[model samples]
Every structure is written in C-alpha cells, then in structure tokens.
Target: MTASPEPTDAIAIPDSPLAVLQQVFGYQSFRDGQQEIIEEVVAGRDALVIKPTGGGKSICYQIPALLRPGLTVVVSPLISLMKDQVDTLVANGVAAVYINSALSREEMLRHFAGLRRGEIKLVYVSPERLLQHEFMERLGELELGLFAIDEAHCISQWGHDFRPEYAALGRLKQWFPRIPVMALTATADEATRQDMLSRLSLTDPLIHIASFDRPNIRYTLVEKFKGIDQLLRYVAEQPGQCGIVYCSSRKRVEEVAERLLSRGHRAASYHAGLPLELRQSVQERFIRDDLDIVVATVAFGMGIDKPNVRYVVHYDIPKNIESYYQETGRGGRDGLPAEALLLYDPGDVGRVRRLLENSDNEQQLQVELYKLNVMAAFAESLTCRRQVLLNYFGEYQREPCGNCDICLDPPKRYDGTEDAQKALSCVYRVGQHFGVMYVVEVLRGAATQRIREHGHDKLSTYGIGKDKSQEHWVSVIRQLIHSGLLTQNITRNMVLQLTEAARPVLRGEVRLELAEPRLVRVKQKDKGEAVLSRAEDRALFKELRQLRKQLAEEADVPPYVVFSDATLTELARYRPKTESELLGINGVGMRKLERFGAAFLALLRRQE
Candidate 1:
C-alpha cells in the first residue's frame, strides 16, 4: 500500500547529499558513517554496511537515490517492512514506492508507470519478485542508478535467517554490471559477512562495519522461575507502554496472551497458525497503538519497523545469538532508552537442543547446536552482557555497559579455586562422559539410581563437596566451560571435557574467581521512558503523542511515520513555539513543517 501524498509547498531539489540531508530529510548533518556510505554508493561502487538497528541505514541509500540521476531499486525482504519505510519516505516527501503483494494490479500498474516516467526515485521490491526473469526485464527498462539489498545477511546460508529467494540476488550484479550495489544488514557475524560478500558477488566492496553496541537499549537476563508471574510483574512495571513478548511455540503465545488479557491488558497473540487476515489485523492494530503488547513466535518476525517499541521480552531462549540480537534490536529504534529482558530457562536449552538434533543434516545440526550453546553462555554470563554480545561479533569492548542486569546489580565474586578443582576433578572422575546436569548431580552427591549403577558413590571425587547447592556447582561448571577451562561436546552427548587451560587449575597451580550464583532475582531499576523527565515535560510529551496518534490515524500510517518519540521528547523539552523553532527539531523536515508545524506550534503555544 502507498501513502496518500499530502499537500505541501514545493521542495527545491538539493544537488549534493548533504544538501539533500538538510532540505529534503530536515537533518543538519549525517550520523557517523552515513555520509561515507552515501558518497561511496554515489561514486558508482559496491559497498557493504553493518550497523545496529535504528542506526540510519536507510539514509545510506535513500540520500544517494535522491542526489543521483536514476531510480534506486531497493530489495527488501518483507512486505510490511517495505510499507513502513515507504510510508515514512513518502511522508518525508521523497518520491518512493514499494511494489509488493499489498498492491492491487491497478496500483502496481500505477507504480510501474511512475517508475517508467522517472517520477519515483526509489522502488522497493522483494527478492522473489525482483528475481523473476520477466520482472527483471521490466526493471531493465528504467534508468537504474543503484541496487540496494536490505537485510543482506538473508542471502547467506550461514546467516541466522536464510531465505532461498535472497540466494538468487547475486544475479543483480550480473544483470546490471555497471550499476553500484549496496548490501546492508544490522546483524551478521564474520562468517555471515564473508558468505554475503562471496554469495552476493560484491566486488572489492567498501566495507563499513559500525560498532554493534546499542547504548540506548539496556540488556537484562532473568532466570526463569514462576515465569508467567515474573513476566506479569515486568509488564506491569511499564504501564501503557508497547512491547513484544516472544515465545517459542504458538501454544505458549496463546496462553501468555490469554493470561495478559485476563489480567486486563491490551494484549494479543500472533502466529503463522492464525488466519492471514487476523494476523494482519493484529499487526495493524499494534502499529496504530490500539494494542500495547503482541505475544508472538518468530513467525511474527521482521515485518515490524515500529520505532516506538519500548521493550522486547523473550519468554524462551532463542536458538542462536544472531536471532536474539536482531529481535532485541527491534526495540528502541528511535535511539531512546529501551529494555530487553530475556527470561532464560535451563530447560529451554535442552528443548532447543532436542529440536536441533531432530534435523537430518548433521552439519547444520552441529552449527545450530554451537550457536545455541553461545546463546546460553550469554544468558548465564556474569560479565557485561554487552561485552559478551559485542565480543561475539568480534567488536572488543573492555568496559562494562552498566545498564544490564549483571552490571546494574553485580553478583558477588569470591576465590573459588578449591571449588574449581573439585568440579574439574569430578568431570575427570566421571570419565568426561556426562552433560552438565549429570556432572552437577555427581558432584552434589545426588542419591539416584544412575549414580548407584555407575558405582560413582565409591569414587574419591564423589560427593567431595556436598556443602554447596546443586545450582552453585552447576554455575561453577558453566563458568569453567565459558572460561575455556572446559568444553561441552554437543555432537557427543554434550559431555564435559577439560581444555588445555584446565591443567593449571586442576593441578592447583592457578587461582580462580567465580561469581556467586544469584539464587534470587534482583529488581532492575526502571529508568523512565525515552527523554521525558520532569512532570511538566511528561505531560507535554503525552499531549504531543496524542496529537501524533491523531495525525497518524488520519493519514493511515504508524505514529512514528509522522514523528519519532525522540523528536517529540525534544519538542517537550525545548518547547518550540514557532514554525522556525519547530523546524529546528531533528525530525521536522521542510515537508513535515509545512504539513504538521502549524498544529505542533499551536499546541506548544497553548501549553505556555
């Protein structure tokens, strides 16, 4: 679906990228690497960009499309994402259209005509549609300046979310050899990056990999016990806020949504099992601010581009780290403070492993199992979550983020050299053939039939340290594995094996420090919502949001398409009272000022 272009004063086309930035987009300057990427693409060269979500990735291509002479074809993965972006671009007065299933035959013909007439600067199409031989022939008729592949990681089989349709995108460079191509994605490991470069045939591409750290989004890991109660408490902490709760199964989604609804929450469940119309309806309602929470499975994945999503909760652990990172990145897209709470259960790890083991492809199962192990390590980590996350992407950061659950309320640490030796000795005594649970039980002197059958009660290491709880021993073993002192062989029944580094610890030659296992959950302090602090400022911000909702409803677009929460926060803080002052805000472009400036200024004046 296309946005209804609003009536506004004519815009004077800017010649340079920076000029387009100021005049068309209403921003005074470019964010970090944006200008460089824009210039590289405009200079007729292929490039690869890896930035965090809400890091202005769209601007890297959109500006070049405007400054360059011909149409820029954007290969998008999802119809809903294309619509959200195209709506935002159109609202900014950019000549952009998306050709997707949402468009009727007549609407598609109109967009085609617009493209042929050189009226649309940018066109977004899915990989499946763009790969069609007939569709490629039709696009060849247009003056093509550039081809941008959004979510480029999808092209790689090694990526978290591989789409076979995206695999055919390498043909874009072959068809339009001279035209520049830019492949962009927010989450891609080094392997994924290399795979994309080879698969997409990006020729000596100028690579710009931004820091993976998202300072605005706080990371939290909560041990899952009485999970539904914990989830309800967390949801209650942020009343009237919009968030997403992700479950691993459809039944769980329905159960959580029902519980929330029974508790008088504006919540709904979305999954692929639901009717297409109902799923669309739920998505529409949530985007329009009529629903505060949508409990969903991954089937409700990446069609969302909602900038105001304040939080994302994973009711169960994800299969891999990339999926976890991308899903959480959906929150705080406005670069405002948001929260990501992961309710991690050890049982969930076993469930995911069992599912992965069911796969016939042994190689793929190994890859998936490795990824899950890393994800579990992240959840069980006592160090900074951001550090672990960034380290996974090969971006090193030594300092603590001070925002995650671990950093906010650090667990106490003590010299556990004896504990380490005992745990290591037990793994060795068990013939290194047991998983974490079996090892923990063996170490804790668990009185079970298996332990009896194994004749482990007669061993010297058996029950050597029965003073500690089962959880404490388990935590010790996990830390040992994380520190490279041990390795869990997923292919071999997930048995624990000592690493070379464990020799010193096992020999009692090296001291080890380990964090105390937190038996109880610490209450994470809530830093109030994005940017509005004072009572008066919050009141004004609320009023601004009400106005935004009304305008967005009338326009039939998401509220963020009108203006981001970050921009509204600035309005509330600075209290811009004139057209000039409102135009000074980051999101208020020439088109927006002409269309919305009057209403915002009037409200500000009234508040004064």
Candidate 2:
C-alpha cells in the first residue's frame, strides 16, 4: 500500500538492499550473517536476529525498512533507544522520527502528520505508546510496513529486564495479518529465545543467532583487594578514555564518582536515586563526550548509544551473566580494541543472592538463584571466561580465547586434595551451620569473638589453612562450591554444606586438582593504540573529531551521528579529497557526503 512506485530518496529502491546499504548506510558489504538476515526481511519474511550489541543488528531491520513498501514501526523498550536510533537514521538522510513521552504534544502531532502522509520511513514508539487505543486507531488508518521489535527479550518474564508491556506485543501480528515482523535482542538464552518467538507469534520466522563473542573486548577479572588502589591503577593506564565504572549501590556510585572527580577523571555519578533531570543531564553529558566516565549502578547504560567507550569496569559483580554481558557490551561499540574488567570479591555473590532471596515468588527466586550461580561460576572459572560465557548461551568453542585472564596466564594447579580436605573439614567442624566466611575464618584460625564463642579453636581442622592467605582460603572455598563438592545452603542463610559428590574427595579416593590463587598481570597497556598510529594522523583524527563535535552541536545531535571514531580514523588514513573518495569510506554515506563533504575536503587541502 505504498502511495507510489517513486523512490523516496536519490538512491533508487531497485530491489537491492546492497545499494541501500552503500548509498544510505555507507557500508561496502555486510558483516557475517547480516546480508542473509537483511534479504529475509526485505523479501517480506519475519526474522529473529540475535546479533551481539555492536554487530550491526540495526542494519538488519533498517535496510529492510528502507526497501519495504510502507513505514516500518519499530517497537522499542526505552525512549532513549528510540531517540538514539532516530537521530542516527535522520543524520543518514532517512525520514525517521520517534514519538515518546519526552516529545512535546505539538511535536508529536507533527510526527503523526508526517507518518500518516507516508513522508516518514521509520517510526519508533515504546510498547506502551504503540498499544494506546488512540495511537492504534491512528495506525490503522495508514498503510503499515514491517514491525521491528527491538529488545525482544523483554517479552519473556525470564529475561534479564522483563517488561509487562512487551508481553502484549503479540497483538501486532494478529492485527496486521500480512505484514512481516522482525524481533531483535542483544542477549537472550535458548529459553528466552523460544519465549520471544512464541510470544511475538512469529510464523516460522528466519532465526539468525550470530556468535555471541565480543572478541574486541579483552576480558579481565581481578580479585578485589585494595579496590581503590586497583581502580586508580587501571584508570591511570587508560588516560583520556570514555568508560563506565559500575557499582552495586547508589552510595558506592556517588563515592566512586566523587573520588574519580577529585583525581581529575571528569566523572559523574548516576543511579536511580538521583533526580530525574540530573540523571538525564549526566547521561546527555556522557553521550556528548563532556564527561570522560560515568560511575553508576545497574540502572545506567540501558539505552546508551555512545560509540567510543573504551572500557567498562565493574567495581562489583552483576546479578547474572546476561546482565554482565549486556553491560560490558556497552563498550567498544565502534569495533576498536576495548577492555572489560571486573573487580570482584567472592562475597559479592552472597550480596546478590540475598537480593534474589527477598523475592516471594518461588519460581522467580529459583530462576534468579540459578542465574546467580552461573554468574558466580563465571567469576570463579579457571577456564577461559569467553568460553564459559559462550557455553552458557549454548555456543561452543574448542580453543581458549587467549584474551581473558585465564587464557593469558594459566593459573597454577596444585593437587588440592589436601587443601580441599582441609576446607571441607573446617566447614564440617563449624557444624555446616555457619556461612562460608565463618568457615573461612575458622580455617584461617582468626581469634575473633565468634570463633571463641563457637569454641572451634581446639579442632584439628582449625588453623589448618593458616599457611595460606585469607584470599587463598576464600578462593579455595569458592572453587569447591563451583566444583560441586560444596553447596551453599541458600535456604539457611547461605551456610556451607557438602554434597554427596564430596564423599570421594573427603575419603581421598578422588584427587582434587584445584587452581592456586592466580597472580595478577596487567597486559602491556595498548600504548600504540591510544591514538592514531602516526603523529600527523593522530592530529588529523583529533581535528576531525572537533569538526564532528561542532557539526553535532549545531545539529543538536550526538557526535557519533556526524562520524564515528572508526570513520575518522579511516579519513585520517586516506585523507580523501573528493566526494567519490569520501563515499568509499566505511561510514561516509551519500547524504553526509553531500552535506559535509566540501568542508572536510577544504580542511584536508588546508592541512596539506
């Protein structure tokens, strides 16, 4: 029901998504699995694309929106996500707009008018807004295109961030019988995936699950001791880079932010407890590159679209592996080398588990507890962290990544049969009623009052682990829990209890080969990568960034919309002087070349 066969823009819709990809989005070819997904959607087929955060998931639906006959309706979870997508789309010359609570009524009316007139190619609305009776009636009056559901994982109750409104999205297919619908999510397991498909009523959709590996990110996990010192050291290694340091509580967020600010890091604090306007301002400043880092709780980074974030540091462990993956995915979005470092204490698991325990719903509690166990396993895994994560999502890799801490410097393995026996004996001597920390203290032979009250000093297992550091003892306890020889009794204040699997180890019939406490090694700080390789190119890249900032400020948009850092790097390398040459760059599309090409060419000429 498109109004006419006339193409919307200069780039003719000649039944080729490749042409649209080049002239509009400025890409020569699709990345792995993108071309096939785009072809499915463009051919009026429903699709389910599970691409990683930075793997160009947007293109799979965006190109189809361009090639489709009518306006594509994108149902998004957050208003910020909608705004970010529409901003980039409009910057690239697509007729895209969003209607959300942030928009004025008059602005919303104008968008509605444009949408009804078929002048807008893509319209983004929240699930709540899309379900409004008035909005649905308005939509019914116009010719509809494909339905693109971003963050489709929220439809399932088991997803990391479930939303009730998402559950109502199944009405889309029932209402628009003929139009195709595509669902996209950055993180979801097989259960969530199946739930997403069934909930959306997707009829035999083309399911594309790209590899969940974010190879650009170097994963590092450090045992948290002298946390502030460790943080300071890591920050010192990464001077003048954008990052997010995630804390578990609002108090810690403020403290970390204040300390970073005092140390001249240009940091801001963000949490749900902050004032609405203040939080928005901090997010806007961070996205605009005015702030170098944001020290925040998990509430932050939901819809962050900043592309140049060089690192993501977790000052505390996340609630689950999915949350961890999604949070770390925020960094290195430009596909440049980046870092994901998590400083954690094994005790952090108890704190997170307690949060899960407070829930009254038994089913929900079980699900959350299982997820927490998996997250803890990830933090404590002696195997490759990437392999563990991929395996969690049912993806397999034969070789270790060599990027994570485990793969880089393999942890030393000692026949911990004696050590394991010592730890288990200590837990049992403590009557299996006390928590892991208490058992650890009993093993460490700490002369605390609780130990005195328990009268456990006389036991043979007591002081057995005094030869090892307290951290080493904690690591041993964690490894035993992970190895199935010990289980945390969550129903009973998370006390330590041995499983039947411990009998062989306890009897010395089974040998336990546990890894020793690993020594920390910081990879030589990617110094050559701090800037462009050559000095002149570095200067040009900086100048180009300034130009981009200026153009973005003028247009009232994020700087990434003007040009990403990767594109600027290419521009600096190639020093393209002509429109054709600029178009040859990865992110230089026709509309951008036509708008800002002359200015860049003039600047390059002046530089020469």
Candidate 3:
C-alpha cells in the first residue's frame, strides 16, 4: 500500500542504450511508469513491478540486465519458457543459457559450470531446478549480480501458475542476501502483491504498479451460444494473421484446433498433457509463424516473445482478472492494434466457482473469486473497457478509449432503478437459495415444471418481471450481480443473494446503467476457389511451401511442422534475397536459416 518514491534527477541516460531501445525495439520512449522502475532496478534496488501483461514488464528487467554488471539469474516457471527467453536473449547478442528438466544431467552440469565461470550474462532456470540440492549448491558457487523472479505472482498461492517450489525461493535471501532481487509480473492485484512480498521475503521492495490500460487492445464480450461460428468468421476476416484461442480444457483445445484446421485455417493444439517433444514442436511452429492460430490452454504462452500476434480469443472466461490480463497481454505486444474477445456464459462462471472451491488455500481462493467478480463486472460493464481495467490497477482513466466495442457502439442502457428494486426483493423473498435462472424464471412468470414443483409460481414476485423476456431479466440480474448489489451463493447451489450494496439500488436511491442482452448472429461464408493474381509471387510462395513441405517430410513433420505461412508471407512480402535477411524474420532462427535458408532464397531468385 506504500507509494512509490519520487523520480530522482541524478540518474544518467546514455544515448547508446536509448538508440538500441528505439531502433531495435522500435519504441520512441519509455512509458510513464517504466523509467522509474528501470532506474530503481539499475540502481541495484529490490523492486516489484505490477504492470498489465502487455505493459512492457520484460523491458523493466531486460533494460537492467543490459545495464547492470555481472549476470542476472532469471527464475522462470516453465522449461519451454526458459528456452524461448534464452533464444531471444542470444539473438539479441546477450550471453544467455538455460538449465531445465529438458537437459540431461551432464548437459545441466555443463550449464552450471558455465554459470560458475561467468561465461553467461543471463541464466534462466525453472523453480523446480532451483529447488534441487545440487543446483542450489551450484548456484551458491556463482557470483550472481541480480536475481530476477519472472512471473513473480506465481510465488503466491493466489496466482494462476502457483508452484510449490516458488515458495521455496524465500531461502534465496539466506544464500545471497546482498544481491538485489527484482520480481516482475504482468498481473497482480493488491492482495496478490502483498502475498508475493510476504512469500518471497522481499525486504521493503519498491513497488511499481503501472497503469493496466491497453489502448491498442479493443475488448469485447459476447454471449457464447454460437461461439465457434463467430470465431471462424473473425479469423477468416483477418487472414494470415497470428492469434491465440484460449480454452478451459485440453479436450476443448484439441477440438477447437481441429475445427479450425478443418475450416482451412492454419492452426494447431497445445497443452501440458502432450508429449514434451510434441509441445516443443507446436510451440516452435507457432513462434515461427508456421501456424496462424494456436488453440491452447493457459499452460501455453508464458514468456512467449512473439510480438505481432493480432488477437486473443478466450473461449471461456478465466478464473480471475489477473489470468485474463496476462492471457490477453499475449496479443498486441508489438504495439500494433489488436482485439481481445471473451465468449462466455453463465455455465463458465459456475465452472470457475467450482475451481475456487476446490483450491487448497481458502483465503487465496476468496481473493481469486473476488478478482473474478471484478472481471465479470468488467465484462458486463457499460463503461469503457480501458477505464474499468485501469481502475482495477488503482489508476483513474476518465475518457473512453474510443477503440473498444462498447465505446465504438455504446450499449443501450435503461433506467434500471425500479428493476433493481424488484430483483433485490425477489432474491430476498426467495430465501437466497435459488440460482439466477430460477430467480429469473420466477420474475418472468415462467411456470415451467420446476417452477410449479417448487411452488414459486404462487409468490407475489413470480410475475413481476412479465414485461421483460427471460433473456432480458437474466442480463439485468447479471449486471446487478456485477454491481455488488447481488452475490452468487456458491455453497447454496450458486443462488443469488442481496448484499449491503444492494440497499441503495433496491430502494431506487441509485441509478444503474445496465447493458442490453446480446444476440448471437451466425456469419455467412463465401464458397469460392481461392485466387492468386500475383503469379510470380504466388509461384515463389508455392515453391517455398513445397520446400518447407519437403524439409518437414524429411524430418517426418507436418507442413507447418517446418515454416509457418506467416514466415512464407514475410518471405513473399520482403523477398529477402539472403540468409541474413531470412534470419531476421520473427520465427526464423540461426539453426533454421542454416538448414533451409539457401533453398528458400534460391526458389525466390529462380522466380525472379
């Protein structure tokens, strides 16, 4: 709860680092909160950065890693993530190495030896590895300059990716108390932040809570009756663009990916249940732009550095706002325009509620549920998306973002003061033991078999909402739930209950801007053969695909198992004539360029 210190004027700025940041990273200047956080880390002070997932949290640590002396030990949560970060670091000419479960004993020992020799400037390790006795002893031998905990929120039980080993990190202070530790996370609410501080044993750390507003990301939440058809239409409209579709389960991930593939789109499935090799292959393909879309669970995309992702579609609502923010942050990292869509239903909320009940820590569970309530409010809110998100992070955003769906096409809001009172009265009369559907049915005068069986049709409030349809009543109830006027009783079969905040609204003391009910409209498809007018370019693209197909075939891989269409599109667009140019593409690497660059370039030249 402490405020961040005022910025000091004594910090020196070098033109070289600024030039690299602007020219290579393509940023004009540091964002408002970024400079102070960077200076604090540069000064070797322990700091905690709570920025929104696309708010440039990486830059906070990356800049300090570049400026500080000695190597920075980055403890990440996943093995695949370490590989991605190390690859990017090496690409940028920063000496980096990773030790993870993927490595053999000897291989890991070699990396540990490298760390002791100070041969690497950045060493990425998983929390599990850090818990190993041998790895701990090896780490003790190294002269670490800075200890960075990426996704630091995971150290708290409240975080989405909470790992038991992260709690073990408190022992780091025992070994190297003098070394500054910078904990960086894209999403952490106030309670989660405090939990992280206590769990990590951070000493009076400077907290940098950046504004969570993402202006480039236009937020939209739609009723999810016809989600798949809507998703297909949205993706088809943005042809060849990279995006991620997040589902709740592995089964859904595979099903969605297969459905997209069947519809003639480049897509793939990713989840933790897959074989390590298969997961790596899918991740490589997606990163290389060999796949246009990746249907994945929350397990994917941690520390993924792909910047040009255009959209993130949530097939189900996440458990909390932190999870949602981090997942959506995956899109639009390149500072380009992107969209985040959440397709959800009342069933999704039930699923999340069950998950909360199943968690081990009751306090953390309550905190997470509260965060979910906030996210639900955001989804059902009639105000600007940017404003709601920023407000959650304790920042005031006055004006509408103009880019979000609600801002572009504002929802119709009726004066719901009286309706609020009726809903509240109904909940109170029904004994707070019935769910939204039952409550709504009673209000709509629906005398279905269940309603009559419960004898609710005889109640005075049973037909009060006869003027509105069932769907309309449901929307009003949902909005009221989000407004803190109503609470879902998870223990009592997820029933609706009135809270203290409901009194003013129920008594017609406060006006509420409730959103209108949304309808799902199916999209029309175009049935025509795809045409290519650029014969020469099309021929080159074909040859590139063929060559990729050949390489993948030799490797016993899928077509996208080699290079993605995005890479091919870039090849066709840039017409890169050399291996060097090819290596500069988003997903192309030195290994790939060395192996297949010549053939791709030769085909391009032959076409010319």
Candidate 4:
C-alpha cells in the first residue's frame, strides 16, 4: 500500500473520469456502460445499476468518487466486503476507510478526523450504522459528494437477500437531497429493480442494466447421484485452487467439510451455527488462500470480493435464480475461465419446496415456490444453460453460449414423441392438479393411498406409462416443463398444468425429441484445466503466487489485495521487462508499480 496520499499530478486531469480510471485504477478504458454511468453520477444524477458480478460495478462509482469533489460515502452490506474494497482502493493509492463494527472506537475516531480534514476520498459504512442518528447527522456535516449503495437490492423485499435495515436507507435521499445516490447490485430481477427504485427513493435515476452474461463461466448441471463422491471428484480436479461448495443445511456443511478434510483437502465449514470468531476465521482463511475450499450454507458468501474463485459448486440447488446467479457469479470474477457445477437431484426439489412451504407469509411463500420451480426448470433444462439463465433475467440470446456443458457435450436424443404424448395426456387426464411425483406415480401404476383417494387409478392415462420407470416419467415431465409445453403452479401445490404449446404435441401434430433418461452413473473427468496452459507459464505463475502470498503475509492482507490472480496470469503471460511495460498491465497502477515493481521485475529477470 502507498505510504502517503497519491499525488494529484498522477491524474493529469483530476476532473476527468477517464484520466482517473487509467491513472488511479489502472484500467486503460471504461468497460461498456461504465463511462456513461460514471458520467451520470459525476453530473449529480441518481443511478440504479444492475450489472452482473465481476462486471466492474465498482468502477462505475469508484472512478466518479475520485473525480467528483468531496468524500463519497459508500453503503455496503458486509464488513468483509467493505474492508476488501477499502484495502483494494488503498493499495491503488486512493484514500478510503470503512466505518463498521470491526473498528475500535479510537480507530473510528481517527477515520472521523480524516473525514473532517477531507483527507479521505471514500468512506464505507453499513446500512444500520448509516441509519444511526448521530452517524447520519455527522455525515450531514461533511461535504458529501455521492451515496453509492452497494448490494442495493437488499433494501427490497423482492430481492433474494433482503435486510430490513436497508429499507430505512431511503432517508439518505431525504436527508441529502442534492447528493446523487447510486444503488448498485450484481443480482436484481425486474421486480427487484423496481422495488429498489421505489424503496430507496432514487429520484428519476438513470437505470443501466448491463448484459447479465458471464461468458467466462462455464455452467454445468450434473444429475446428483452419490453426491459426496461427485463433489469430491469435482474438487479433486481443481487442486490447489480456491472454491466454494454450498450446501443447504449446516449439518450438510459440516459433513461435506469433514469429508473433504478426510480426503486431504484444505477445507472448512462455515455457517451461522458456528461461533462468530470461527466463522470469521474461516472466512479470513479462505480469502487469504489458506483454505482451498469452504463448505457452507447460504449464510456465507454475500459481498465476497475475492476475485480468483476458480469454481462454485452447488452441492444442492439454490432457492432462486438470483441466489444461484450471485453465488455462482462469485467464481471467475477475475475475467478468467471458471466453472459453476450444480449437482441436481429431483428429490431435492421436494425438500426445497417443503422448506419454502413452512414460511408463514403466504405471499412470500408463493414467490419463493415460484422461484424454486424456475430454478428446478433451469437445472432440468435441455437447451443452453446460459440461455435459460439469461432469458429468465429478460436478456434474450438467440445463439447458444458455447461455454456451458450442454453446448460442449450435447445429451443423446431420441424420438420420444409417444412418451411426450403419454406424459401430456396423463397430465390432462389427471386434471393437472398434482406435482411431478404424484403424476409419475399415477403414470407408473403406483397404487398409493393418495392415488386411490383421487380415483386416478381408473383414469385412461393410469398405467399407460407402466412400461417406463418412475424416474423416466419424472424426467419426461420435467423436460416438458422446461420445453414450455407445461407449467407448474407453485401456489396450487406445484400442480402440473398444460400450456397452449402442449396441445399440438399431445395431439401428435408436432413431433417431440427428448433426452434419454440420465440414469447412467458417470464419473467426473479426471483432468484439471489450468488457466495458465503452458508448463513454463504455470511455473512462473506459481512462483509469482508464492511471492504474493509471502508479501500478503507480511502486509497482513489477502493475497488478492496484493495483486489478483488475473493480473498475475497476465504478468506471467506477457513477461514485462521494464517498469513501463509492467505498468501497462491492467491491474498495475502507479502506486503498486512503485511498491512492488522491482521485486516482480527482479523475478522476471531471474526467469530469463
């Protein structure tokens, strides 16, 4: 980190946002939609930004924070997020501090003094702290420039991770009418975006919704069978890389973490059930690259700024697309190739549905169940996973994304026109009032009590599919839902309902093709795909990582805070021989070049 403030001369034109981007943040140019958003904020207009994670959302505000006058107050959701961002900014020679519970009273007062002296460009605070009367009043005393609310979706109930404290943030606009408020989030659907605009009272904000596609992330959905073995195999393939495995329960988290440890992986469990200090330690360890994997429940991984997460494995399905997208988007933040592997089981659908049904709020439960069905549909989708994901967020992509598993290895198809007709006919005959399990049972000639009570046994469709296994029928039904020939009504007990598209298929007017039932027990590929493909580059990258880890240990910061893996990969790829060439790299600013240039240059010199 720089020992003193960055000289104003570093940015040749202090008021120019592009100049500040290159000089202070070391980016050669603004990413698409970033420069316009930054200019809007700098021009004193509110903005609601809906960009995907790793999409440079921070740059939309950070550059403006530097170019605009006065201190920019950023509202972040987690202390770790604040600290990581502040550390990154400090490393880049920008004066930034986070005011949160982590700080001692003396440290808080020192930061307050800095703020009073106008020595800090940005100050981060939590929503709860920002709402405190004294802190709110104290902020009024400063020459406030902008209020950038990170994870702004938390303010809305419609968002995946809603916090009541965020709802009170609308007072910021009322308290400081002229200070432009920029609410930014990586995950927000249409409803969540509208709710945020209303809840945060963003005044006629410029809404910039960047394409929600992470092309670098390869989406893979694997059927869950012997899930522990599958998880172990997946993790084994990515040895020594940092990743997160998300489970649905604390017990599952512990079990997975224990199994991983037994298999000799650097792993730990994190959940709210653990002691606060233990959770904090696990998080810190993971961020520092001391832990190769963290098996955790949904309680973890909000506002995580670790850019080099190689993969995110969902040991179980997520509750919604927003949660799934945000969680999986945690990987490949460094614009490097990464993977999102979800081990999906049909049984998990019932478990998740039951969990959501317990919610006392009927409206909320309905919303959750609807989202869960959509999540399941995505998992069971036959088409491009990226297409299904992006289509849900209202981004239409006609062309298939070649990075996903479906595109890479297309499933074997068969002429299942008769089976599709059978499934569709069964749904219609059974009155379309049952879930997949019940429908499958009816089709498979199961004489269960519920079936007898409903008199479904006497229906024409009953036992029509007896030749097919229950798993086969279930796959057919799910595929039909994904093909848009049927819809599941979540509020009506997730009953199967035929859509208009099903009419033609049921009447045999349109031939249908479906995937063969995926019951074959398969093994994960044992190959490890390294980002640095060449042996010599990988060797140099390893040495650079070692150097970074040593420096981070000495500096008491996460290794990424020194230099992201992406930057290190670039350093290894393009062996810069001089200071100018090194500074030309994307992540190296003047401050970092001055601080660690000679050490890296010496290492490169030795590599020669």
Query: How well does each candidate superpose onto the true structure, as a TM-score?
Result: 0.69, 0.67, 0.67, 0.69
lDDT of 1: 0.83
Query: Would you list the C-alpha lDDT of every candidate in the order shown?
Result: 0.83, 0.81, 0.75, 0.83
User: Could you tell me which 10 consecutive residues in candidate 4 have the lowest summed lDDT?
Assistant: 1-10
The residue-by-residue lDDT of candidate 2 on 155-209, one tens digit each, is 9867777778999998898989789999999898877888888888898799999
Pairs clashing within candidate 4: none
> On residues 319-391, what C-alpha lDDT tens digit does candidate 1 reach at each position?
9888899889889988889999998778899999998899887666666887898898788787678877886
Residue 27: error of model 4 in Å? Answer: 1.7
Candidate 3, run of 10 with poorest lDDT: 1-10
**Which candidate model has the greater TM-score, 2 or 4?**
4
Assess candidate 3 and give its lDDT. 0.75
lDDT of 2: 0.81
lDDT of 3 by residue, 1-608 (tens): 11111112212323354654665456799876878777787787888888776677777776777677777888888877877777765555556777766777676667666667766667788877777898777767776778899988888765656667788887888778888888988877555687788877777788888777777888877756556877888888999999999999999999899899999999999998999888888898998999999999997998898889999999998877777888888999888999898986656787888878888877667656766766676766666677666645545554568987678877656677778788888888888888788888889888699889878888889899999777678777766664556766533445777877777776777776665554221122242112345777677677788789898988887877577776776676557554434655655776676667787888776755
Ranking by TM-score: 1, 4, 2, 3
- CA RMSD per model (angstroms): 18.2, 19.1, 17.4, 17.9
lDDT of 1 at 240: 95
In model 1, where do residues sit more than 4 Å from their true spots?
1-12, 275-277, 299-305, 358-360, 414-608
Pairs in clash, predicted candidate 1? none
Error of 2 at 132 (Å): 2.0
The parts of candidate 3 lying over 4 Å away from their true place are 1-29, 372-377, 414-608
Candidate 1 has its poorest 10 consecutive residues by lDDT at: 520-529
